[model samples]
Target: MINEFIKNIKILQQLKDNNVYKKYIEYIRYPYFRNLAPDSKITFDFPVTFLVGKNGSGKSSTLQSLYGCPKGYSLGDYWFTTELDPIKEFDKNRNCFIYGHKNNGSVNEVIKQRIHRDKNPDYWETAKPIKRYGMSNSQRFSPIEKDVVYLDFRTELSAFDKFFHFLKFYSNTHKSKQDFLRFYTNKLKEAFDTNKIISYYTPNRNKPKVILTKAETKIVSEILRKEFESIEIIEHNLFKDWGTSIRLKQKNINYSEAFAGSGETAIVILVHKIFSASNESLILLDEPETSLHSGAQKRLMSFLIKECIKKKHQVVISTHSPFLIENMPNESIKVFSTLNTTGKFVIDNDRNYREAFHELEIENTNKKIILVEDKTAQILIDKTIEKLGKATQDIFVTKYLPGGADDINQRLTTIMEITDDTYVVFDGDQKKLQKPVDLNLMPPNQQDTSKKLKELIKSQTGCDVKFYLNGGDQSKELKEKESLKLAKKYLEFYKRNVFYLPLSIPEDIIWDKKFAKKLLKLMKPEKDFSLIKKTSSNSKELLFNFCIECYGDSDQYESTVLQFVSNWINKEDSNFRIVKDLINKLKN
Candidate 1:
């Protein structure tokens, strides 16, 4: 079955890419001022746009506004219109296609309409039978030169001697047919008290082949005389007339009356319509999901997508089903709806997903480690470090797991268990945020750290919280007189926000020089904190950074002496033992 579908589409549209170029012609969207919008609305990122608005919100009206009701322009073949360009807006028009509606419009539906309308050009051209209570039966083809084989039921005609034509033609305009009503369509009942060949699919090794009975083959070869010298049908039976009624060749097929039901008839006609226009038409389908099960709907959509691509036809479908769009690319999908009385925001991205939440964990480490919050930041870290002449691999950087602050502590445990070198840098209150609680974490007095630290403030007008990106714990240089400024502009354009709105994170990451210095200060233990005796760590850069951070201003001479003395002690490896041995020998 799959192979047959593929082959059918393959032969029909194998013009390479060139064949599809002809189809690139987009049906005109006549730009006109819609009262729905005060100004011209522009949209993008999707090749097809389906309008969906509440009734009277101009969904149908918008479609009408785009399409011209040319006598020939119709949404379907079932309408009649004689209104001549009610508005003369087409003098400057180049290319446009607007068809009548009322009858469902699809490739199949459009093809049949085109065929019926083709022969009735004279009647449709002048009277526009689409809604004119079109005359049926006994109406000869105008010009009387071409042949038309009308296959309509006998019930549509009311009188004898008046020819019987298309179905349900009771008026100059449509008088709805009871047979094709929706209730009758879902019986799961076959329409025919009829005899016909049953076509079935079979496999030849791996390829697909159509199988048919002899009678069915005969009918197909007879009707299809153009291409095959010998034709094969895909069904297994043939219709036979028995005493003024039709019956199937298979047993248990005798119908008391022998006429096919309208449901089956509709399916036949619809299929014919699609097959005919499969080569050329921009088929639009609305609510095909009606009367279809979820599985059927999926199968139908799959068939349609394959056919459109293979036949190189353009198709636009409107659906609210998320399942239908899961297979489509994000940019190819556009959501059209109004969020306000005045404007509609168009979402061109179809693949947008909510960001998973996670925060970073910071802990003491023997080695230096850098951590970032998200993918964007992760990318920036790698790229920025590369730009700064540092190899990414040289700087062990990782992202924290997503979630709230608790996730940060959870992640820290995981990382600390694996490596000794790690550092976490992010944002919090500008007053110098600390772990577990930010700088905003205050005593019950609410006197605020900034208020008490005023003795260290040069500018106290900074924001409540700001982002601080600090590293190299050696720079404990907080100005005794400064306060952080709050900024709201940075968080507004995260680029991942669902509606591009700012997220309400506690204290949007704030920054200040003191924020960097505070980490260095915190590294020092209390006076009771034990210092390493004979520390032999090879990473001198980190140790120096720590010393500068803790005692940056303490005894400049002592600081210089500490570094030289540490170097001299490391150099004494064997020399110290040798000096001790020499002293003993001299004593002896």
Candidate 2:
């Protein structure tokens, strides 16, 4: 299901790039916003995007900015000047943002600034574009005309939680207080049993109705993993000045939000709002995973994607949930990182799931870990794993350590001690170090590290380790010696676990003559291979230059190149077989 979702998202991305599926707000840029660097821009390439980062990294601020993109919405609705937090009118650094939307086959930019007025303070209104050299002003446009539904899950409370926990009762005695609660509970039960609208005679009359449709009930059930006969909402004097309460009925069981799980109540409200929203509305969700379990979060994301496709809605979410971000296309995710020098958040738009996991400090403990020398090698192995099907892909995870083979080799003992399921892989160029004798040929630091590893293994097992680098072949003399059988046991562990790539380096496979030709045919058909060969000094340089020429020197160019390389390695070739065998061993 996740694979299909990702494939559909990729198709949508292609359509968006071709201008076939136009988005209301194409891109947003902020020259000076709170905690964000100057001139930081984020493009809404996909209809559904995720803004992910640590706490206080401006994720919610970015979501607020998007919420303010459509007409009739303003950031001041959420962020306003208080007594302690005031906005200065004469500040040198202004708070403003600019966004572009598609207008009749062209993009029209609108600039909004926080201007202080006598009547309205800290108000964001449309302002004239700032003049820049060599730039001319076309016809200005107004804010986008679309309905917006902004939901901050963190602040949302179930109808029951809000009423009982926050509201004040007139009775001061304990007995009177119990009677107050019983009166309200009985009234809510009567309303749910009769399936009738309940009204309250407060300063402002209020009536709550059952808003869930039959289809919406099923969706809510699936998302929350709960089956309900019926669900109703009641807003009466009991919840006056608070909010509505939800009454759920399940096979001989009846309860309100007071007894139901928090996640259940949140999903019920979320589904209702989404189903009732108008088509093409801009839906902004802040931390939708607030109370949802992992499974529920994924189902909610899947439902959001399906609804976005159906209604032509633009959905943007700010979250810290890996489950929500895992199945999303890398292009759909925008990572925010704080810079130490400036103490501001900077956008990193080229991160994949593994990199995002590292940023979030999340570890997939269920999957087997395969450690590689660098990012390129990791990509290659990951692509190969994908070809073995979804089950294989789900069983293994690849992580790349920086500083190449030396890093893994230096920390080999520590890594082994940490997890027995972990396996180390190196580039084919480092295959020379497979033999113990070759340790002497390494640099001084590496030689000392290798000696320490050897000594440690011998001391622990009381056996001298030997490496049969070539398919674990043992000499006749060594095989006959029963005394060295323990040595063979140690050799078998390394032989079975450690591995090297089939090619000398990642560039060799990525820039192979045949693979490079195929990639060029798709990316740049007019450019010949001779141009790349003559200009580049080595295979790595050739790969880099080809990517630059084809995709330009953008932040996404490197990932674009690796994606193509991964596709090339996904074939049923010698290298694929080698990687597949290694993965099978790990699986066993």
Candidate 3:
């Protein structure tokens, strides 16, 4: 399968001082190669995979990278590819092809390229070793494997015409013509339930020369009729150098190729190729979204996906169409884009997942908006707001906009214009919290909050607070002293609250397990409070589920903390509180 075959993509950058033009030795950068993080692993795990992104985001480059593997476009050649060699690896079966960009435009280009290719090349004059250097002229050709079918949205009816007529001329030597007819008829019968062919001859001609069999003429008519219901195939010439010139009868008027709509012609040829194709071949599609209407795109993708599932064929697409990407699995969607403030190619899986959810309208939204980095921050903030019972009109009626941290910050002005009450929040990624619960700052009544939280932890796991903070005593260290193990258990307790409260972790967090794991390692020994806190100018909300879960009456502690933060912001303290500036401006 194409998905299993293409295992990974590693982006390389051109060396600063290089002897070779296309020689790429250095990696772009980890966590970000260009628009995507270099360490990101893009896997083809579905029968149909899609490459989607804004123009110049490397969607086209990534598509071309896969299609022109080993050598093709330069890493720096792309608009978004300042320095990135997007390399793709295939499994044992390196079977795939690339069909270039397609739409109303590409059908012309496809024909032009084929028509312009050098049919014959010069032979080597002397039997000497030939040296080929520099990046070769960009040619889009896939492996010559039986399991490959490179199809663009540029299926010309003339090509199909030439193919069918060529078969008729040399019908004796090849059995493939019969196979094509059988395949076409089988699919047609399945769709229309008719074994009889429909043929038409021009009525004006005293004796219309019928150079083809009735079945052959009828087959052409029937094939086109499916796409153009209003038109019927009237006549066809088989022996002409132009191959087949089909005349159509529409509403008592005769029409030929010149008179037919581009859309209708396209669909007829496209449908023919699809139904007649062999099973299990990788079908590469470019911009089907641009060529077909919304309804046609939907119907075609649905049909092709189902066909892939049944026949074990694979399909890959490069498109800017949301209609196409939204229907595909998140894992199957490869997004190409430039990261913020950095001119680098980013193969973003998390943002791609957002595209998928957005297509289904599954992204959570409320009447009011609270812009947060991701779902995890959204859940924590929503839950914390509820716990605090702030009674502000915003908390009861706000929805979270899960744009990432950088996006929210970049678009803060625009978001504020939408609603003055909009607040930005993020996970505790700004800086490490040391002894998060400041004992000196705690009010007299709330002094026992930390002790009580510790007691709750001991009750749940039968481990003392010191055990978690100090990695246990020397004797108990051997039994269970690992900070990660303790953090996992603690995280589990808090994570349970998230589910019970009915909140799901965002894919961004899930995809990067190392980040979360390392976070826990950093915080486990720091005596950080489990409670959520608004930490930075970015509205970074650092909260562990264990902290939220430990409090018996989370409301009081939450209210107290909220009041303290509000007081600090009201003071407009410039000494230490970084978030004070943003909150104070909002308050005014």
Candidate 4:
């Protein structure tokens, strides 16, 4: 677990020099950290922790601050302190590994060793004995105490000469291909742990080359094939005075890294390095989604999660992919953003309201958002909005919430909290009832009417009425009137189309405009049907029932309404002016 190596991190008020800090403390600063919480504590509760933020929101800086500072490497100008695991009773030092993107455009993993000078480290000290505990830069040895290995994609494919030499030594020592592979895998793990710091002999003027047998080549090929479909290791080349080399085959063409797709090569290299990492190693991925398609990104993440869990490795990722973030435990995520001018801030991920809008991919922008009731309202609102010239390319774009009237309050609160430019458009039928009634409790008379309405609705419409009444006032008369009006408006929309379908059409009719029109008409029965209820708004219900008789189902009538509205909005029309006006009013 990461807590085993790093307990907590604290941003310092000043560097060792005590120079006046300008940005991190007073204003927006560099190297990622800004206005962080005092005694900021990040825990490793899950095997994987993801840091997500917008560009310049400090994801990279946070990673660097947490574990990216190599012992001897200069981190430019940033300062932070960490609480590490105390040295074991028998151990002389502690080591921490960090993997990150290096300044040279390559990924590097560094292992830094810390030795305690004071026997009694619990007490404060003006000065204490301390020294870098690991072997010299030229020497390599497995970490005997606390160690951290920072791995990056670039590092996985780097140190070409050393890698080839290591391969040669292992292949030469083991004749059995499987044994060679096992040994090879172990050595790679060692290299990853030590950051390739072990000693290497100076090469002689003539280097010895060791050829790999066909079986050995096949073993390597099979491994590559699993990652890259159809990719194979063609052969291994050993030169008398040169190091070892391997060739690859792809799509019947011989290729090397230089000629291969960088994405594929990067993936293979990164996966190989990960597989070679020792169990329980702290793994930090800057952005595994880089250089991968959506499918590949998901597959790689799944594979990595499984492998890390099985091996007890802890993984941290800093990324911007929703596909990566979705479905993970809520607490495992830490969302970062620079919304505050003073510094970056974190948003809670577990809030259900946030999750609901997250499904719409809401970003911090000036885009307009429209919250409506359901798919039917969504269609109507979108269609109406589109009729007002250009719908989506205006100064602000609009998206709708999928909830209905009852959800408006929560949706508005959540959305307005995120952005001020928003509009809540409810259905026209949601207008207040002519006579106010207690909405909190269902009335006995209304409850019976609801039952009758449900039966009438199901038999006449052949569609579930639950969705229509969801979040609606359950008053019998109001609901029935609203449903009838909605159905009436739908039929009106269909009849407005010159080619609206009739009762039925021949099965073999070609699916052209005529057949399409007939297919829509076939949704209804041939005879007219009437409801003999007396009401103030009987005209609307009468029209609705007429269309239901012709269409057989209220759902098909609604579908035709949506189709007509969609087509109407897509073409030249002027009826959306009222919607455009309402939106303008809401924004103002």
Q: Which tens-of-lDDT digit does each residue in 56-136 have in candidate 1?
A: 343443343222232334333422234562222233321122222221221110111211244453122212222212223
Model 3 residue runs over 4 Å out of place are 1-40, 69-147, 151-261, 350-588
| TM-score pick, better of 1 and 2 | 2
State the lDDT of candidate 3 residue by residue for 506-539, as single tens digits. Answer: 2222222233334445546443432322331212
lDDT of 2 by residue, 258-311 (tens): 776567677777888889899888899999887565567888888887787677
Candidate 1 or 4, higher lDDT? 4
CA deviation > 4 Å runs, candidate 1: 1-19, 33-272, 343-588
| Model 1: lDDT to the true structure | 0.30
The TM-scores of all predictions, comma-separated, are: 0.29, 0.60, 0.33, 0.36
Give the lDDT of residue 446 in candidate 1: 38
RMSD of each: 28.0, 19.6, 25.1, 24.7
Task: State the lDDT at 87 in candidate 2.
Answer: 62
What C-alpha lDDT, on a 0 to 100 scale, does residue 208 get in candidate 4?
A: 28
2 against 3, candidate with superior TM-score? 2
